[model samples]
Target: MNKLTLFIIALLLSPVAVAATPIEQRMADYNPDGNLTFDAKRGEALWHQQRMVDGKQRDCNTCHGKDLTQAGKHVKTGKVIEPMAYSANKERFTKLKKVKKWFKRNCKWTYGRECTTQEKGDLLKYLSQY
Candidate 1:
């Protein structure tokens, strides 16, 4: 390549890459560890515990079996989704961006609150296991 083209390439690549956002950085702190393992256990408990939603006490296991490898379909919408801990579905989590997004939505749907970092890690561990 010509020197001018090389110089332009160098200039284009010179700027330092911007860092991820604080939320992303904080989320990064959620590596699977003992704490996450513990949280996963707790998440399992929570997933099974019935709670009042729309005046109905229901739980994830009410529809999804204790084993997360089973399939679940949305009764109201008739939409099919994979088992929460299905290994066959692992490729779907290739991006952490999508992982966090789904966690936020699903946790709320199941538990009515955003999961803790440890809980998130635990869920990931449990899913990875299956």
Candidate 2:
């Protein structure tokens, strides 16, 4: 093989190329052990948990819907959200920017506060499973 071809192959096979995903990078703070230790069950529960917001109940399911594989509509804007599950959607948690953006926006909207590192980690863990 040519030098350039070999270099490209080596780069592709390097540890950096096979390193943790964007979600994993975000979860690193909560998962210091470098392992996926977050509880998916807890994440699932948190998604369904209803919180009283301004005398109204709100949750991730409020817009994302109960089924992760199906598209959901925004309660207020009526905007359609793409399916979150990797099974149903080819792209999910593939971009760090989008992931951070949505978590920040959605967490504040649902819980009235910024989510903790653990909360974000758990949520990503739960969503990635599907």
Candidate 3:
């Protein structure tokens, strides 16, 4: 093969070339909001916090499990949810669209509203740590 073709092949085969890290991609979502910063501490707190949902307490941990590295089950459907930690599941937040979609769906389910960009950034920062 020619040098140019070989280079292209190598680029295609390299995992790093495939996409940005979950944290990096998540950060891009936060960048447009001037002066916003993501805090893993806040994310962790959010992860465990309970909110009133239909007159009952609900939180991300209710469905995601206390351990971010471990797989969790859907509280109502019994369906398996992949681990949220970037370390445990490299696919977690790599796609911008998928991340946005889940944040929209999950935030509403857990908090009965859309998460602010700050909340999304914080949660992603927290989850990416493990």
Candidate 4:
């Protein structure tokens, strides 16, 4: 076999590795004994922070309202959404996958960029505390 052929075989058999920062490695880390409670304060602050989007500045509260406790309805469809009260929506949040999806969407909407895992974790922690 030629050297190129051996190289190709090695590449196929080698493990795929991606580098991640320590914070990223630990962002998903949770303390089993530590409290996973919510802290609405941080979520509230993140929700209102203005960031650049499409070269324009915006924030989540621009559409979602500063106080998330009130029920919001789809302006056109009139579909209502519950307040982001943690206890009221505990079941929906038991799965981390669901939480990540929303974080990606909401982060882009509010910050115009995907939030770091730490930011997502912190936001989720704060929300859970509520």
Q: How far does residue 40 in candidate 3 sit from its true spot (Å)? A: 0.3
Instruction: Score candidate 4 by lDDT.
Output: 0.58
The better-scoring model by TM-score among 3 and 4 is 3
> For residues 32-119, what per-residue lDDT tens digits would candidate 1 score against the true structure?
3434333446655656767788888667765555567776776567667677664555445656677778779877887878877777
Question: What does candidate 2's lDDT look like per residue over 1-130, in tens digits?
Answer: 9999999989888987668765556567457776656777888888887889778899998898889899999989999999877568757777767878888898888888888777788887787786
What TM-score would every model get versus the actual structure?
0.60, 0.75, 0.78, 0.53
Residue 75 in candidate 1, Cα distance off native in Å: 3.0
Model 3, runs deviating above 4 Å: 1-20
> What does candidate 4's lDDT look like per residue over 1-130, in tens digits?
9999999988876644444333223234533444444344765677668887567667755554445555555433767766554545544455556666777787876776898654666665555555
Q: Supply candidate 4's per-residue lDDT for 65.
A: 47
Please give, for residues 10-124, the per-residue lDDT of candidate 3 as tens digits: 9888976657676777776777755888889998888777888677889997888878789998899988899999889987777788888989999998878899888998888
Cα misplacement distance, residue 89 of candidate 2 (Å): 1.5
Q: What TM value does model 1 have? A: 0.60
* Candidate 1 wrongly placed segments (more than 4 Å): 1-29, 32-40, 62-67
Backbone collision tally, model 2: 0
Question: 2 or 4: which has the higher TM-score?
Answer: 2
- Worst lDDT window (10 residues) for model 4? 18-27
Q: By lDDT, highest first, what's the ranking? A: 3, 2, 1, 4
Can you rank all candidates by TM-score, best first? 3, 2, 1, 4
lDDT of each: 0.63, 0.80, 0.84, 0.58
Segments in model 4 whose C-alpha atoms lie over 4 Å from true places? 1-43, 52-57, 74-78
